[model samples]
Target chain A: DAGVTQSPTHLIKTRGQQVTLRCSPKSGHDTVSWYQQALGQGPQFIFQYYEEEERQRGNFPDRFSGHQFPNYSSELNVNALLLGDSALYLCASSRGRFYEQYFGPGTRLTVT
Target chain B: AQTVTQSQPEMSVQEAETVTLSCTYDTSESDYYLFWYKQPPSRQMILVIRQEAYKQQNATENRFSVNFQKAAKSFSLKISDSQLGDAAMYFCAYRRAEIQGAQKLVFGQGTRLTINP
Candidate 1:
């Protein structure tokens, strides 16, 4: 009955550094997607993972990548972080590619 | 490339009154899905309501309802008997209806709603 859960509620990283955020999808869900929400703006899609392979990706650069484990958990990694990378990263899970997606509380990444 | 727009940056309503947030999207595909998500101060994105493009009936959830105009490509959310708890940032999102692989959601800029008692 547990919903989507993300780790490290808040994080601080310096420029040119790397960071990884984790997410455990909701029970009975398989697909995981990541999104970035900048200040005063809505979330922008980062990418989606299904069957341990990346299925869809947004316009994000190569610096942003993700991984999905067999257990349906996911990790979002951002390399060479910049101040603009500071935002709330959200993790959403759904039963399949065409189902309703439920989101987690999100990890707040602060690039210093 | 689909884009969702929420022209209202902010809106306010008196407690127990009603308020509507506007949203419009541009998509080349005819079959798609639209959603309204509520993000509170806690930053959790909660699904408020959703509308399927093929369906003529607008989607409704409890006190929340949507007016979907397919031709106009407009989707607006109406919150009835608004309460303080309803004060939050509301986002409009769109997704394609492809049955094959996963699709990413395109979100609007978001409308911040403030409920005054």
Candidate 2:
């Protein structure tokens, strides 16, 4: 079974540009969550999507948002990107609100 | 806020020997879950083992195991019969078993492991 899949293994964008990252959860999972991993640091939670609605969000600003489709796939959008937005964007999926999660390889975003 | 700490930045072990990575977390919640994830150079997060606060027996998966101390708030991972594939950045994570979307993982910085022949 496919665990989890993400698009655009690597990306480069300029400041003020909008970028969207996609994620497909594991076959049996129903919840999708997004995180940001900076250099030499652990991942920080961005937000979570369930039932086609945003359920929870982290410390991120309005510039960051996400959506969950009917098929359990999700997308993360970052607008007005700042130079500090350059980092590894990670997507994790679980069966429910809390359970064993499976993560994707992650998309490395470089904001110039 | 819950925080996980991995003091050892790096460690090395003989190919066939055993190694343990230490981890300590600070949380006010009594009931929570602890997990160990291995991230290789590919940057994929792989689950190694997990432990529940209510469970007394530590969780073990094949050659990977965890030492969970609820009172001390310590969760350590012990790798037996270390292999070359085991060389990766191991992370300690904490999650609340809640029903809300607030249930998210808090990860430690990470410990890079190296295996020598």
Candidate 3:
């Protein structure tokens, strides 16, 4: 079975620009969660989507948003990106709320 | 709010030796799940080991095992016969046991493991 897959292994964006990262969840998975891992730090939960609706979110601001399609793929959109937004965006998928999540290779976003 | 902490920023051990990485978490919920994930330079987070808070027995996966002290809220990973491939950033994460909505994982600051041959 194919694990979680993310698009654009790397990205470069200017300040105040918007960037969208895509993720295809593992086969047979239904939920997708997005995380942001800064350089030299652990990943911080951004938000989670289930049934095409956001069910849970972390301490992130409104600039960070996500969408989950019926196919279980996800898109993380960051608006007005700042230099601090430069980090590795990771996408994780699981069967449901209670199962273990499998993470993707992550898209490294470099906000210049 | 649940928080995971990995006090060790970096650790090194000789090849074929055993090393233990420490992790502690703060949570008010009585039941949850703890996990150890290894992120290589490729940036894929691989599940190393996992332990359920309700399970008294520790979880083991081949060469990796966790010392889960539920009462103490401590989850430590012990890696035996470490190999060069084991050199990566290890993270400790926590998830609530709630089954209704999306349960997001809270991760620690990650420990960088170095395996010297």
Candidate 4:
């Protein structure tokens, strides 16, 4: 089965520039979550999307937002990006009632 | 709020040997879940193993196993017969059992494991 897929694999944007990362949930999975992983650090939860609505969000500022599509694909949009926003964005997919999430390779965003 | 902590910043093991990574979490909720995820250089978060809060017995996955101590909120991962492919950044994570927003993994800073041949 196809696992969670994200794009583009890498990105470079300047400060104040807006960027949107896309994710396709794993086959047969319905829930998608986003995370940010800094170099040499574990990923931190950014937010989660279910049923096409954002269900839970982390401590990220309003600049971070996400959407889940009916087909279970998701997108993470970050506005007014800062240099600190540079990190690896990970997308994970999971099915209902079970919390074992499958993750994508992640999109590496570099803010200049 | 739930928080996971990994005290070890790095660890090393000889090929074919065993090593353990430590982790602790803080959560008031009785029912929850804990997990260990491995991210190799490829940067993909791979689930190594998981343990349900209510389960006393540790969970094992072939070469990977967890030692869960509920009273102390300690969940450690042990990797046996380590190979070069085992080298990666290991993260300990926790999640609320009743939470409904997918597997919102609260993660530790991570332990970088280096397997030496």
Model 1, runs deviating above 4 Å: none
| Number of the predicted model whose lDDT against the real structure is largest | 1
Return the lDDT, model 1, position B88.
Answer: 98
Worst 10 residues of 1 chain B by lDDT: B97-106
Question: Could you give the candidate ranking by TM-score, starting with the highest?
Answer: 1, 3, 2, 4
Off-target runs (Cα >4 Å) in candidate 4 are B99-103
Q: What TM-score would you report for chain A in candidate 4?
A: 0.97
| Regions of candidate 3 where Cα sits further than 4 Å from its true position | none
lDDT of 3 by residue, B74-102 (tens): 99999999999999999999998977767
Worst-scoring 10-residue span by lDDT in model 3 chain A = A92-101
Name the regions of candidate 2 deviating beyond 4 angstroms. none
Q: Ranking under DockQ, best-scoring first?
A: 1, 3, 2, 4
lDDT tens per residue, model 2, A37-93:
998788999998888888888999999998999999999999999999999999999
DockQ of 3: 0.88
My TM-score estimates for the predictions, one after another, are 0.98, 0.97, 0.98, 0.97
Best-matching candidate per DockQ: 1
lDDT of each: 0.96, 0.93, 0.94, 0.91
State the TM-score of candidate 3 restricted to chain B. 0.98
lDDT of 1 by residue, B10-77 (tens): 99999999999999999999899999999999999999999999999999999999999999999999
Each model's iRMS: 0.9, 1.2, 0.9, 2.0
lDDT of 4 by residue, A26-67 (tens): 999888889999988889999888778787888899999888
